[model samples]
Target: MPSETARELRRRLHQQQLISAFGREALRGAGLDGLLQDAARAASEGLDTDLAKVLQHLPGEQCLLIVAGVGWGPDVIGVVRFGTDLASPAGFALRTGAPVISNHLGGEGRFRTPQLMVEHGVRRAVNVLIRGEAGAPPFGVLEVDSRDAQEEFSESDVAFLQSLANVVGLAIDRDRDRRDRDLLTREAHHRVKNSLQIAQTLLRLQLREVEDPEAKRQLEQAARRIMTIGAVHERLFSGPAIGLVVVATYLRGLVEDLRASLGVGDGGRPLALEVTPASEEAVWDGDRVTTLGLVATELVTNAFKYGRGTVTLRFEIAALTGGGTLVVADEGDGPPPGFDQAKGGLGMRILTTLLRGGGLAAERPPEGGFRFVATLAPPPAGNGG
Candidate 1:
């Protein structure tokens, strides 16, 4: 037989494995319900207990809700709730960031349902508070019960269970963070899309008043640019990731819209816009998309007006000698030599302002086609595509 120390080490290793698995499973779970279920199961296995119950602190209700329970009857777990104002041991433990250990539940002064505890044969119990991080409120509580009244919990047992509670707290915080981020992202996208739609409507109405064909054409081009911005926002609202719009997908949709808007039917051979990323995917923030959309509008609009052959738009992140460069290229005749940035009128001025606002430098490609290159900073970490 193995020595006591060897058996203890083996048990701790098993517990560590359980904690790691629990953390992963908890994160993958859909919502708070899934998290509660995972926590209960993990707690039971990690603490070697027959019964485990998870109680989330619902401050609005002024009570601890029994979210999940394992190895317990409906009478014992279902009807048990601790009020915030009540002086129960469990509540006290949670409020004070301490642990409550009762070898005999019937004799415990703070248990509200001593007779129920006796009826259910819950002889001993322990409740630990799952406190949140520094400066945050408590997340919840973990309650473990055993039928054996004589079984006394060791200090090591308490420490191990406390570690499990810490993991639970971390999981809860992460889920909350993810939810808040998603909400903010959705709101931002919704507002931007609404604003762009309004701008498109205004531009379309203004186009009707302009008698000059050239002026009407310019107005229409500006409207199309606004529509492209709206398209980016639409993708952001529909996609799963917050604050991230896929460059290739956004470009493809924009090109298709441009083809339809320009009245290039199936037989007419629509302008082809293709984006090949340097990486598998390129994710841009709202500000970046706004700047890039304007640049794309200028290039694609010029292509439609002047280019004879097919028009293709490609985007790639390049490793510049100094830093990274975002290149937007199209298969069209290059801009006129010495193209005046300031004298090219409102469109060029808007493009210049947007690029400068995003802390980027834009220039045309040296080869035959029109290409706009902008140097951009890396996006924030964890803003996944």
Candidate 2:
């Protein structure tokens, strides 16, 4: 048999191990309910007890609600309530901000054993207050229980429970902070999107009042660029993936919008736009999406103005390197004689600027059509990986 001193050391070591594990989960940002449930279980296991619970104080109702627990009936957890007065052991710890050790609840005079505990044949229990950050209201109480009549709740057990309670408080606080930051980021995106939309609307009004073909074309191009940015922001705030734009969804939407704005070809027939289906769960950062959007708009616009027949836009993922390729082609006799990418018009200048280091491939496909291929580097690590 282990000596009394060695046995005490073993219990302390076990308690420290439980505390360390609970602290890690809390730091990992587990949700509030999950943290509370795990805290209850940890408290019970730390003390080798039969049951444990975490009660959230509802000041409005003047009662402690059993929000999480271990070894309790489904009806008891989330359904049981205890008064806040000092007569109750858990209440005394919560109301007075002190730990309570009730080892002789059956004959105790200091506090009453809750009826729910009595029904379960509980003979001893310990309670500790779960406090919030400084200046914040107290969260509630954490309690562990034992059913063995010979079981004793010691001061060491109270210390372990308090340590677990502190970790729970910090986790809840950090979770709230993270939620607040996320909300603020979403709000900022929404505001920027609305502002861009307003700018696009103003540009469209200016385009309507002008009659010079040159000026009208410039304004129209500017409006389209603004629209692309606005659309990207809309997707960022509207979707579940944070700071990411789905490659397929974004390109498809952009092609449809451009088709609506640019209208039909010289043959009085609707312009044909073919978008290849997305093959992977690939995503890109906002800046990359914006650059790609602008490049696509320029190439597609040029195809409609100079080329003829169906315009096809294809996206391919490099399987080994995780990079991407954008292929924009049109069924035409290709660019007129002597067309150079680095020495062309405004559209060509924009394309060259955007694809400077990214590598651009322009050729007349074997079938006698113009094709512009842009290579996109993979997104940074931790984004859509």
Candidate 3:
């Protein structure tokens, strides 16, 4: 039979392995609070500690909030807050950048046990700093305590607790990095989008003065194209940084912008631009948004200007490829018989140039109306589901 010492050694080694795994799994999930909470539970159960907790130290505060805890009743985990005065071991470990342990809590005179600990009958404890970079602030403390006065903690117990705290520090660092990246993404998106919007507004203002019909038409086309780029930034701004974008949410806003451009009561009738999304989880990156925006704008604008009735925009999963298809169709006169499309002016040439990079086809369906279909290339490399 194995000696008692050998068995205990194996158990603690197992505990460390389990706790380390928790950190890796938590990094793949969301939210810092829940991650810390799970660490507390693993520490408590694996180490046979009566109370385990993960503390969060606010920048300007002297107290640590119980962001995650195990063993405490529901009323205390998130609801109660405690001070981390130098007199308490948690504060001592944090300040000294080292772990602290009290084998017999009440007998120790070096630190004062808070009243909450007294009320809970905690008689022994060990706390370790959830250490961060050297000279930087600590993440928080991971504390394990024995409520029963007879329970005692040895140096190995303290060492195991320190290892658990280290795992938690890894999780904290990852969460902070993700948050910083998200902030930068939002900031960059806002700057680019805002600048484009300002330029677009200025162009619209200048448009109010031009008198020649031909010049006005050319300027109007430019403004609409600028709006397409602006919409790309807006879509990217509102979504996650992973580069996958929701299609319906993006296109709906573009549709509204087009409708608003046509002044109410000034146009022949209030245009009802209907948008039907297949509602798949298809995602597109910024380039695709700008390209499709221009394609949809040209086809739909042409429909409203020359075709007739309500314009319908549809996005659906393409039947054949790893991409989606965007269709702009309308109930209107087909292109003039044998019309000279090659000479169809600026917008037509622009549309043709854009499509060569994508996939495009046009048809006057035997049943009637005009339809222009474009295939959005599969999301940028590494950007798809």
Q: Highest lDDT: which candidate?
A: 2
Tens digits of per-residue lDDT for model 3, 1-385: 5798897888788787876688677757657777788778887877786688887776587777777888788877876666677787888877777788887878888898877678888888888888755565897888887876665677777787777787677767777777889788778878888898888888889889999987877777778878878888877855665444666677778777777664423455344444444445555677766877888888777777778666778877653454667787778875778776667877788777877646767778887778878776665456553
Off by over 4 Å in 3: 27-30, 240-244, 264-277, 319-322, 339-344
Candidate 2 overall lDDT versus native: 0.83
Stronger candidate by lDDT (2 vs 3): 2
Query: After best superposition, candidate 2 residue 64: deviation in angstroms?
Result: 3.6
Residue pairs with backbone overlap in model 2:
none
RMSD of each: 6.8, 3.0, 2.6
Model 2 TM-score? 0.87
- Steric clash count of candidate 3: 0
lDDT of 1 by residue, 104-208 (tens): 666767665434345668778777888877889897788777788666666666676777788778877888888888888788779988999999999898988
Tell me each candidate's TM-score: 0.63, 0.87, 0.90
Deviating ranges (above 4 Å) for candidate 1 = 1-46, 50-53, 57-100, 104-123, 131-139, 147-150, 154-178, 267-269, 275-280, 316-385
Which 10 consecutive residues of model 2 have the lowest summed lDDT? Answer: 268-277
Best by TM-score: 3
lDDT of 3 at 338: 78
Once superposed on the true structure, which residue ranges of model 2 sit more than 4 Å away at CA?
58-63, 238-240, 264-278, 381-385
Better of 1 and 3 by lDDT: 3
Residue range with the least summed lDDT across 10 consecutive positions in model 3:
262-271
Q: For residues 176-279, could you state the per-residue lDDT of candidate 2 as single tens digits?
A: 67788889988998899989999999999998899999999999988888888887887774444566887677887887788777865355434444444454
